[model samples]
Target: MNPRTMHSIFLKKKRTMVAIAMLSVGSISAQTFSDFSYKGNDKIYTNNPLKENEFYSPILQGCYPDPSITRKGDDYYLVNSSFSMFPGVPIFTSKDLVNWKQVGHVLDRPSQLKVEKGGVSQGIYAPDIKYNKYNDTFYMITTQIAGGIGNMVVKTKDPAKGWSEVQKLNFDGIDPAIFFDDNGKAYIVHNDAPPKGTEQYNGHRVIKIWDYDLEKDQVVAGSDKIIVNGGVDLSQKPIWIEGPHIYKKAGKYFLMCAEGGTGGNHSEVIFMSDSAKGPFVPATNNPILTQRYFPKDRRDKVDWAGHADLVETPDGKYYGVFLAIRPNEKGRVNHGRETFILPVDWSGKYPVFENGLVPMKPKLKLPEGVKNKTGKDGFFPNGNFTYIDKLTDKNLDFRWIAMRGPRENFITSAKNGVKVNPMETNIKALAPVSALFHRLQHEDFETSVSLDYKPKSEKELAGITCYQSERFNYVFGITKKDKDFYIVLERTEKGESKLIASEKITLSKAIKLQVIGERDEHQFNYSLDGKNFKNLGGPVSGDILSTDVAGGFTGSLIGLYSTSSNDIKP
Candidate 1:
């Protein structure tokens, strides 16, 4: 989760966490990649393992943020914001919430997403998923900040069977959520600007409710009204009152929203109303969930906590899934914001996130009648884990994603690897390029892959990218210069690219490229015969790859990329 998007919320507004791709090209210049491995070495994960009934805090590790959850009987489905990544909205399934597995994406086709031409940070924003029991269907609504598509919705009877095409909504705002009343009435709630002239402060926003037409998939015209003005209190001129969701509890309406932007001061506040469209009053104890009040220097801190969605268990327990940043030891927003879960204490009139006001802990007690199955059997790995992908004709894992488009743009089948046809557009291109990525899931991790390729000219290059966005990233690749082969490490910050280091290497058969991250520092290395790796860019600062420094809504992606439009030189 990018606090920068939090800025967009205010204005409007991994771990070895590497999405690295492995390239294996033939000696004759036929590009193929294989034998890739990623190892998470964070002490918090390696030293501690889940007990008999315990699990980690971040059930879905890596850049899975802006979490929204819904329950269909014993089945629970969760989704997260994917920004410009193709197959937008990473969807997951869980029986116990603690053990979650990805069920593919909501927007898996290009026709459903119009983000190929926009910048990486300008695509899909906050995505809210809900279940309308009235129709026996699941709904996902979000703001596509690019390609002229504002707010839209997609539906699916079963998430595993893919979703419907984008049904453009008539509302105008971000983070739109749908609620279905037991009487079969439906309402739409979202964050929008105040009435034309009533605009007060810079970031003053309002929560508006609309009578949604379920049959037509549109909001009722002239049926919109502002519910909460400038958050819990108008006098303070609150900023970014967004990510609103409405719930009916025992004949009362409960409206919850994220306030105070998406930075260190981010928070979640709740309001109550007897009716869905009537005047909603703020709870006396607002800010029911936040880490802003906690001391900044607290140990194992979990900051920037807000933008939450709630779901009730069959046993009457309430849980919230929200976005929060786990800063590195250097206090930098490292590996971007991730999805975290906590029990909600709704025994009172209003629900409160348990232990949310204090320094957050990593261990969570398992819910009754559920076993922790993380890091095994395909449930998303949290705490610490390793992933090995031997690239084949079908390409890597299902989670290996591309930006702005599909992976078919370049990947083909090889004997034991993927045959990649480099794209004219490089990694820096805003359009679809030839690269495969995985999210950086941990603070300290090591990723390596072997490449067997011979560049024919200076135009062809292939390597790994430690990418935050197209504007800010580190590209390390092998290219031909004049008559020699060289591996170049280049860093780009805010659109400015600078060559960090490069090395001339003798290509015997294949070479192993590796990147090791120890918190704020990352090192790039290469080995000719598989062992005795030599560092290329020795300990480069990872500040540019953070959400705090780069200013975007996603995490750093490690990519195995092949591009014919190579520009970096040794």
Candidate 2:
């Protein structure tokens, strides 16, 4: 063949290869898996046996920020920023860091806080937990910013039951961390906004360590000594430093903290000092874990990763538990600030990043001697009678949280399952008092609630809702139209509620509706006998259920709701 003919054939082959590559990219992009899914029925507990030199960690779910963990004997306890969400300061326990169970809340009573309209983002900030061997007490310091209150401490021998009345710590700052040295002395470290007139709560701040009086519940000595001042550095502009946890190991004090904003640029920085109060030295290799170091390939970009705490295992292994966000197709992260565990190694006198500079994805290894029994209740367990009993526990699962702050008389125990009374408030105002909900725990899980509703008036609405917020919500309930039974599906976006789907239906003395939420999709089905079902196909679309769009301090919740112009009495 001539040279011209060969050139033409080469061009054709190049064009064909380019087309195939583009098709492959399109196919890969078209198919993506949901972040949270049912990972089969594997019983992996926190304390299960581990092979030698094996790494184990937890699948950090929800918004767990400013994580403070303490190891008491072989057991570990962890707490995060509850913000305004009630049952504040969720306390989790695990024999190992891998598997954690919701033990209880540090604050259960209303007197602990008066957060009515702060929504979910204003109640509690990062809290530090410590065990006082001298008094044999567990001390926790939480910051309540909505009330402009200083830090408050709660003590108890047992954390699972309840805590004492909050002992007010008269200190001004946000993320409060408590450090107990081996010398029987305690110090409190926190980030304070620049005096009063300087600026608002911007980044330019410092970690101040003060001699704290546990008995007096106040800072006894030491001025606000600027320990590590990253906020002053001009290079890292808009320096928002917070979430400081102090750990003393091998005669060197490590101040591990979250720097930059809690959003995409969030990071975990480590500093070292010879004493509790320091001219702390920045770790030669700072920002031990961050997205800047952990690059995302073609899969997903896990951003806003920081706010970490270091925990040592029973067998002397160091692990860091921190929060990170996984973005969706729209570049939004619904599973906000999830907790993750990565191993850390000691190099020379300081800690070094494992697996080069990139964040190490170590193989998870369960601890020795534990049991995990997840998903033994069979698929679609809403109809299972035993599963219904588990939902009524006063210790509400981490899967559940109130849309607004929870009211005292909102939810009560009924003979059947749970009873939610209507509050005398519209869904638009502060403390709607009408909604109770749980997190959309699984992507493809089915949730159904049985409630016998007798609408007192045309305004009263009671039913089950998948609520992200007031503006973005889907409600399925019985509307009082000519006293006729009808199931209605309402969708709200940008504070506007539109009736998406409604159908007339016959109901017996009782009514039940089950919502099957698929991968980024939802379906509402009604059943009178709880056996046979009718599919109500009125699909709703909004970002409220998607964590990336509805920006709040908490996750999506599914629960019973009742709204009324007058007070609802059961």
lDDT of 1 by residue, 1-570 (tens): 332232223222010111122233333256667888898887776666668878888777678889999999988999989889986898999988988888788887666788888787788888989898888999999999877889999887888767887888887878899999889999889999998999999999999999989899999999999888998889988999999998878789999999999898899999988998868899999888898887778877788999999999988889999999889888877578889999999898999999887778888888888888887898877777788888874535768988897676557667768766686798778898878898998899999988888888888898899999888899988999999999999999988899999888888777889999997999999999899989997899999999889887788888998888889988
lDDT of 2 by residue, 1-570 (tens): 432344345445644654554455321211100111112111232224445545333344545666788878877888887776665787877775655666767876555655677655678888888877777778888798665566888777877756777677766777888888888888888887665575534567767778877677677854557686544243565477788888888998988778877776777788888898986777666677777545455343456777777877767667777776655545544435666666667646665445424543324544455443222322111111123323445434454555445433455433344445565675555563656555553334566666666663556667777766555667777665666656777776667776767777666556666777544667888777867888775554536666567776555666567766522111
Q: What is the TM-score of each candidate against the true structure?
A: 0.94, 0.80
Best by TM-score: 1
- Runs of candidate 1 with Cα error greater than 4 angstroms are 1-28, 46-49, 393-395
lDDT value for candidate 2?
A: 0.62
Look at candidate 2 and tell me the lDDT of residue 384: 12
Clashes of 1: 22
- Global fold similarity of model 1 (TM-score): 0.94
- Highest lDDT scorer: 1
